[model samples]
Target chain A: MDKVLRDKKAICVFVLPAFLFFFAMVIIPIFMSGYYSLLDWNGMSKGIFVGLRNYIDLFTSYNNEFAKSLGNSLILAGLSVFIQLPISLTLALILARGIKGEKFYRTVYFIPVIISTVVIGQLWSKVYHYEYGIVNMFLRNFGLENLVRDWLGDKGTALICVFIVIVWQYIGYHMLLMYSSAKSIPEDLYEAAKIDGASELTTAFKITIPLMKPILNVCVTYAIVGSLKTFDLIWVLTGGGPLKSTEVPSTLMYNTIFFKNQFGYGSAMALFIVIECLVLTVVVQKIFKSESYL
Target chain B: MKRISKKLLCLFAALSLTLSIGGCKTTDGTDGGTTSPDGGSKDKPTLKIWHITASDAEGNRTILLNAIKEAEEKFNVKIEETGTENEQYKTKIKSAMAGNSGPDIFFTWAAGFSQPFVDGGKVLNLDPYIGAVKDKLLTGITDNFTYDGKVYGVPYQMQVGPLFCNTELFEKYNVKIPETYEELLTAVKVFKENGVTPLICGAKDVWPAMWYYDVLALRTAGSQLCNDALAGKASFESQEFIDAAKKLVELTEAGAFGPNTMSVSWDNANVDFAQGKGAMLFNGNWVTGNVNAESSAVKGKIVARKFPLIEGGKGTATEYFGGAGDGYMINSATKDPKLAADVLFFLCEKLAFDMYEQNTGLPGWNVSVDESKINPLTKEISDMTKDSTGWTLWWDVFLEGAAADTHKNLVVQLMAGEITPEKFGQEMQKLNAK
Candidate 1:
């Protein structure tokens, strides 16, 4: 059986299909996008060969809303990792231990994860509404009407409101990941800690967190990458409106190709997103490696 | 180890199987619903149409469908009707055309938006059909449908942007719906003093905010200037356009637009206007259906009037703001081009006017225009048609390609009061010059 498995033909047969699939689905589209990125194509027109103008304009043009959108994407990524993870980690630590109705609490927390982003976006849009929103209504009922403002429309507050929605929708997902990671640490480590007369906090800080570093790295990497491609919620909620204060790279690419009819520029913007997301992933990996070693 | 490898192999195979089958299933489903005319001698020929009509619009899809049904019976063919939302529909149409899989007949606006399609040879010239139905359409309504001296599509509707006012609110405040710029400002001030919002225009969507600027721009530059600018003959930074921008800025700073106009969305602004929260809304006649839809205090009190004239401006009060509403164009890629054109003419000529009239849409086609056939708002608009000295296209519709997007973003900034009017004009000029 081992001799048969070692056969070259068998190896080729096993790998060929996936290689073909990867080439067709991933490699081809990337190359096509690269090809399309050089032309002044209006999506339907005979594309004019504009060369690097699209990319040059993307980076240098002051009013390229696409660039602003990319900046928003980076901001979203920063908020997700720097802000969301710490809160999710703390919540996971509390929930991971033997607690009342652990299954029920887990189910309740994970429910939001199952809800589609479209539904969440629509629900939150209604909630963030200026005049008739439940949030404003609640504020009025509590006589805190002065505090109520157009949450999604104001340029100062739009991005922050979107960030809050992202955090609310995803904290449970991150918490679940972290909790399972914490649960996987050897029970014997805790028993050994108790024998050493170590306090629970000390045991947790030294043992559990250290052991969960690999999984935490994975979670943070996901958060960063996921934030870079954040589109649906933002599109459905604000549509990068009220002076496009909440524009992000993905939405920018979408609007460029879809609304503005600038496929070439949009493709150039897309390539920038890919490169930025890659750079972010590498930077995060290096930080995680250093943290784990220490 | 052997068992684990076998399980992994099975999992990979199952995943591939599911994906391949899923892809096949989707294609099959799509084909079953939208089989094209080239399905062979044994198959029934099918024609597809893309539209953006709402389902609730009275007699809209039904009228089009009935027309298609009649055409199918006459031509012995099958027809499929699909409707999508505004922006999505345009995106889908563009992508489909790019991929050479566009529907046989698709809806398109009749301006710069259609230029690329016409230039690309993606849309069929409809001059033949236009000539056939020349007597049936309103005079010169077909002119906007012409590109490069060739008619590309039949115009379905002519929308005139008018000031829709709450008559009851005007009566309550003892202020007339202003006919001149100064009177308009005074009326706004009166409304404000009486604790009523004057004009409820939202800049959130950008287009609604543009209406105020369009009227002001028309008043400042007049039709010749606008026509030249739109034709790419004049600079966007001309004194007229700049002065118009400044006037709009002045209006904003003077509280002409009520509190939080920047925050109020298109829907909310319209709803507020319909509810009498504001005295007037400067919008196209297309809004009559929506205004009538609202179960608010000012339901029947809404009345349409021409835009007020500006002080010391060339534009007459009779000059209007509007364009040919979205029209139907045949995809050049369709195999049965004649059938596609037939379907388009059937929809636009036989069905569109009737459906539009019922839904309170102001069709450009020469339909029976008895006052009894239209809503009060539409009748008022129709009456003003004789008074119209000229028409200015919406700024968003005139700026082509990236310049259009740039121009719109500037408008958004202007609406937000982030950029001064001069800055807005300068930025727009830079974009237009590019």
Candidate 2:
């Protein structure tokens, strides 16, 4: 049995099925997308090979708005890293201290992660509704009527409002990752810090955070990648509308491919998203690796 | 190492077995229904139908279902039907048809929306089937669905865009129903002075905003120029198109719509108008059904009329921005084209009468209706459209491919003051050129 386990043929046999599945599902489709990106085909007909014209149009055409969509995705990613993760980390630190009803609080924080994104999107859309929405209603109730504006309608506020909801919906997911990693930290370290007269905040920064570096890196990568690919919630909430203020790559791809019948152009947008995600993910890993070495 | 390898092998075996069984179960479930093996007796062919009229209470869902039931009995065939929401139905049908796996019959909008399917040779030319019901349909109604002198779809309903007014609100505010574009502006001023929203149009969906642009363009440039521009023969930057855009901007500046027009959804805009929160709504005739629904606040008080004529515009007061749009077409790749056509013909004829009686829409087919049973708003629309000099299809439906998207997005931006009328026209022409 040991001999069989050590054999390269056995390793190949074990890995082949999973590799084949991955190749079929992931690799082939990407190559197909790349091939389709060079054609000027509606999804229905035989494609005319345009030779990177779709890619050229995606960047140079004034009407495409691909750059604007990429910028929106990057903003979402930046917000997730800077705004969403800190809030998650704070909650995880507080909960890891074994405060009262810790388990209950943890469950409550994790609830949104389990709920369907469509349900969350609908829930947020109502909350941002112009007239009767809770946000406006609360503003009016406080005699701040002038402060009331269309949260999801105004071009200035639509993207921000959507980002807030997205940050809120996934806050629990990141919190859970941090919490479990914090739990695995030895209690003796806390005792050692406490004996040295270190405060809770200091211990959290100096010990818990440093100890949770690996999990934090994982959470950061997840947050950034997830942010770059956000579709379902945004699709339901604004449909990338109110003058396309909330337009992102995924929604743009969907509209161009399905509604406009520019499958080749949409494929170019899809390929750009994939490359953007891949490059950014590697950059994030390199940053984390350098930080760990430091 | 041996123990670990054993455990991994067991897990792998379990996973493969589970996946294979799951696959088998799905295939078995689907095959269980139609595997009768009596060769002598002919098995009933299942006619698969897809439609967008899935709304339970009103729309054409009930009418279509009833027609399907009748056809199933009359033709002695099994009818399988799937109804999806309007927006989702487009993507579903297009992808399915593209994959050559679409239903035998499916609902579609006429003209530019269906042109791709026709061009791709994915739609059956219905000339052979229309001989029986050609006289039954309204004259020129089939023109929207015709391409290259061949009718590819059968029209069931005629939708005309109308400006729906809450008569109670008009009376309360003592504002007259507008007769011309200037009068409409005066009404807007009066309503705004009274602290009422003159018109409640939800621009969030973008298409709702297009209704305003469509009528303004129709009245300013007339149907000929609009169609020419859509066909790329005329430029969107023409003086007439720019004037139409300017008029729309003027209306927007005068606060014709609700303050949060861009935020409210299409359904909510109708609800606001129905609840007397707004004085009027400019939308498709489908709003009549929503307004006349039993629970609507302004049920008996709503009135429908064509868009008021623009002063000194080329279009007449009778011109409208709509036509016979929604209809059903047979998939070219269907195994039984004749059978699908038969089902489509039967369903459309029955639907026409059902739709008229239910006040869901104006029937495209020439069907007699008991006038008393029809909703007053629907009747008002029918009467108003009797002498319409011309009808222009919705711009989004009239313009194909990327041009349609550009038109819709530009209209939204124009409404939001993000682009001037001149810039809007230029952008439209640039997109059209592509």
Candidate 3:
């Protein structure tokens, strides 16, 4: 097998079809988007090459809402990193310790990850509904009717509500990754730590966590990229509305392209998303690069 | 044997992958349906139709389906139909038409939505095909589909955003149906005090909220100024436009749509209104169907009327707030214009009749619908429309592309009371300048 792999002709034959498929499906469309971003097109009408005007408008246009959407996505990323990952880490640590019902908890937590995002989005939309949602209902039952408000409708609460749902829906996914990473630690290490009278917390902080750096890096990158690309849940719930307080870049691109028919401007926004995700992924990988060697 | 099995498995994987990838090509939607092999169909060509309603949506889709079934047999051609969800359909149809791959007969939204297609020469001029049906259509219903005195499409549905009031809610709250501006304020005040939402609009969709503002702008500035301002010939910063914005904001401030308008969808608002949760709904005549639907809670308790004339405003109650905006046009690239036009015209007449009978909308065609058999709300609304001196199309439909979306967004903001009335005018003026 290794000798065959060393044959360049065999390698080319094996990889050519998949590479051609990727080039056609992924790379060509991206380049087409780039080319289209330079033209002022309305899908059906003739396009004039406007050259960087669309890109300039994507940032500066008042109604475009691209910058604000980016900020919303960044805020979601921050919350995912600060809140979601910590909770995932804690749960993974506890479960990896071989506690009773560990398998049950692991499987149950991961069920949300396996479920469709649309279902989760709808489930949370109901959970946050002002009239019949569990959140408001719980508040009402506790004699806090004054605090009840439309969670997904109010601009003040909408972004946080969406963030909570998105951050929540993926906790099990990141936890599963971290849990498997934690579980892979040699049993001898734990035994040695136990003989050394090291507390579980100390071992977790010093050895387990340090050893899990590579997986942590993967989780952080996934969280940030996922946050940027979080479209379906937000689209399903608020549609970037209640004054567009919950607008994300993806939703803004969708609205601009589909509703406004500003195909060129929307292409610029799409290209920006690709660049944004790519840059953030690089930054995240760089941040974790040194420690990934652990 | 094991080596042979391994080679066979590898071959199958490659074959399947290639097949799947090749299958990704979009079908023009003409190939899939089971053709009648035993019938005399060797000479029968296929005519493809596209519509906005999803296959699962009951009301309009069913009517369209029935019409297609009838048209197929009558026209003696196989019909290929594709249904797309509304907003997605806009993008799909636009791109498909531009690429010259669109269905022969596709549903086209009237006015500014079809303007690009008409200008791009993608749509066939239907005047030749529609001449026989032209005189049968109600006067002024074909105005939106007529560009430069040539009809590019034909309309089958009509609506004027009428104010639907629930008599049951009004009686329960002891609030009279407001017939004038001052009485409207009083009813709003009373309804709020009695814990009933006075005016209900689903701001979630943004278009419904825009209807509220359109009617207000019409009442404040009259159709002439509204037309001029909307056309950018007159400034939206005019006092009348500001006052219109002020009136819209005033209604929201008075708790007209209630606090959750932005959260509820138009369909949900209809459901809620039917369930007696709101006292009034300013919506299209389509709401009549919802009110008369089998599960409606306000079946017999509903009545629709012209929006009350605002005091000292230029708009008259005779100037209604809707026109023929939904329509269908044939692709210019169709191989057989005569066949497509036949199917289109037949489906349209059937559609108009069904829509009127089902209370889905007012008919654009001059169908003799039985008044007593239709929803009483429809009769009352249509009877009230007999007084209409003029009709103003939905502002969103009248405005082109981004301006259309901007107008709706601005109206939503106005309805939300987030922008001052003056600010709304200024922002609107910005769009007008564009």
Candidate 4:
């Protein structure tokens, strides 16, 4: 086995396909985007390479909606990791233990994960409807009409409303992952704690929570990366409007490339997105490493 | 076993990487040579036409399908309709053109919207083809299709913006059709006092709110100023333009629009007006078809009139807000340019007039269609265009880049009372600055 491990030729044969694939897909696109980022192309015209102008404009130009969108994406990712993880982890714990109709509840929670983001966005938009929606109707009936303003229309509430929708849709997915990880911890650990005269809460705190740390690190990384790439739900819900207040990086990149025909600039924004995602994933993974969790 | 698992992981990663690279490959090739030449299929001479219409989807796809059917029967060629949502359709057409594999004929707007493609020489010059049947289309609309001494597109319909009024609510408030800006204000005041919201506005989409602002600009500063602004000879921050913005803010402060105007969707606003919840809506001829489909309350009660002129402004009542909607263009790369032109002629000349007869469209083509067949409201909009001093195009239709989105959103902010008129003008000036 040690001789086989030291065999470099075998390693080359095994790794060459993946190396080629990585270069073809991720590495080549990055270089291509960097090249295109210098051009004065509008996705239609013959491109003219002007050298680093798109990047210059993206960073320094006023009314840089792309930069604003990047900021919004970071805010969304931050919120997803901070708020969504803890709540999902708690729900996952409660449901992981012996409970009535656990299978039924699991299915119900998993249903949102199965549904398409477009349908979820559209459904939530109806519920957030200012005038005739069920939420507003109920609010008015209870004389809490002052609190029933346009949730998706107001700049103050638009991003938060979208975040709430994202949480509602993905909480089940995270919960299932955590629940499975929590379940793998031996039940005898809890029995041992009980034999020590520990309460149920104490047993859970000492045994189940500590055991699910590695998987929770993965969950946090997934949540951060996934939230940064959010596009469809935000696009369908707002198209980043009432005044482009709720625009995230993906939608802004989409509008830049597709709507405005600024393909070169859009490519720069996309490259930034890739870099941001990579940097954020590393930071998150490092911050919540398995060693720290242990 | 461990070696096999590692190999499987590499295989999966390789597959994903290949897909990622392949996905962006088509975008890199711009020579329009992606589609392999058909050695055998050339006998059939299939003309691929792209349109943003599907009946099952939203938009006027049903009308486009019937038109396509007529074209197919007349030309003996199979026509495929690739219908998509509005935003998706724009992106698809833009990418298709970029890839050089665009459809033979596609939907386009008349002005600056088509300028990039026209300037790029991606679109075919349809001047001679259109010149053959010059007398068959309406004068202003035919002229609109021409850009820089060459005609590249044909208008399918002429849409004129008019004040769509609720006759029942107007009668309830004892309001007559206002002739001047002052008279309109008086009418609005009367409606407000009578507990009727003067307008059912949906500003969230930004385009609908643009109708109000653009029309106001035309009345306040005249078409000359608008043209100058579009040409970059004049600024949107001028006193006259600022005055127009100020007037719109005044309308909002006076409560001329319904409660929660910012939150209402265009569909909901239309429904509210149809149900007599508001006194009026400022929209184009196309809305007549939408309002007609609503429930009984607004079945026959809606009527349209020319937007009232500002009392002391430069624009006359004859000046209207309008555009040549969805100009049809032929691809220069089409195998059979003549055949593609024939299909467009069919849409512009023959099918268009009949489309009007079916209450499906307002024909921009001059083909003899009796206005008597159209609904009275639509007829008024069609007739007003003939005598109009000038038609104010939508801002997005005229401006390019972030300027279009920025200006439209600024108007929305103005209407929502988020920004003052002066700020609107200044913001636009800032956008227009080098």
Clashing pairs in 3: none
Interface RMSD of each: 4.3, 3.6, 3.0, 4.4
Q: Which scores greater on lDDT, model 3 or model 4?
A: 3
Per residue, candidate 3 scores C-alpha lDDT tens digits across B146-193 of 889998888887878889999987888777798887788889999888
Q: What is candidate 3's lDDT per residue for A138-239, written digit by digit as tens? A: 999999989999888898999998889889889999999999999999999989999999999999998899999989999999999999988999988888
Which is superior by TM-score, 2 or 3?
A: 3
lDDT of 4 by residue, A1-294 (tens): 454456675466456666766887789989988887888788777899888888788878747777788788878887887888887888888988869988898889989999998899878888988767788899999999788888878888888888888877888999999989988888888888888999878867778877888888888888888888889888878878767889888888887787677888888888877888889889867776646434
User: Which residue pairs collide in model 1, if any?
Assistant: B157-B364
Query: DockQ score for model 2, please?
Result: 0.49
lDDT of 4 by residue, B291-392 (tens): 777453786888888788886788877777776756789888787788889888886665577667767677877666665777776676667667777766
- Candidate 3 global CA lDDT score: 0.86
- lDDT of candidates 1 onward, in order: 0.78, 0.86, 0.86, 0.78
**Candidate 2 local lDDT, B1-434, one digit each (tens):** 87678767855875785577568656754442232233323687777788887878646677788889999989878887888998889998888887677778889988888888998899999998789888998998998898999999998889998888889989988889997899999999999989899988888888888889888999999988888888789999998899999999999999998678887878778788878889988888888877877778988898887788887889887788889887999888677778779889889989989999988888898999899998888888999899977878998887786778788889989988999999999998986777
Ranking by DockQ: 3, 2, 1, 4
Model 4 chain A poorest ten-residue lDDT run = A1-10
lDDT of 1 by residue, B1-434 (tens): 98669756755775676578568746754553234446535467877878877475544667666777788787777777788877678787778777767778888887777777888888888766556678877777766768889988776778888888889989987998899888888898898888787888877677788888878889988987887877768776878888888878777777777756655668778778777788888987867876777476676888888788888788887788886756888877676777667666666766646755676677777776455757776777778877777887776776666666777777767767899887877887686566
- Considering every candidate listed, which one attains the maximal TM-score? 3
Q: For candidate 1, write residues A87-178 as lDDT tens digits.
A: 88887887777788888887788787899999998788889886678988899999997888888878898888988898788888998999
* B154 Cα displacement, candidate 4 (Å): 1.1
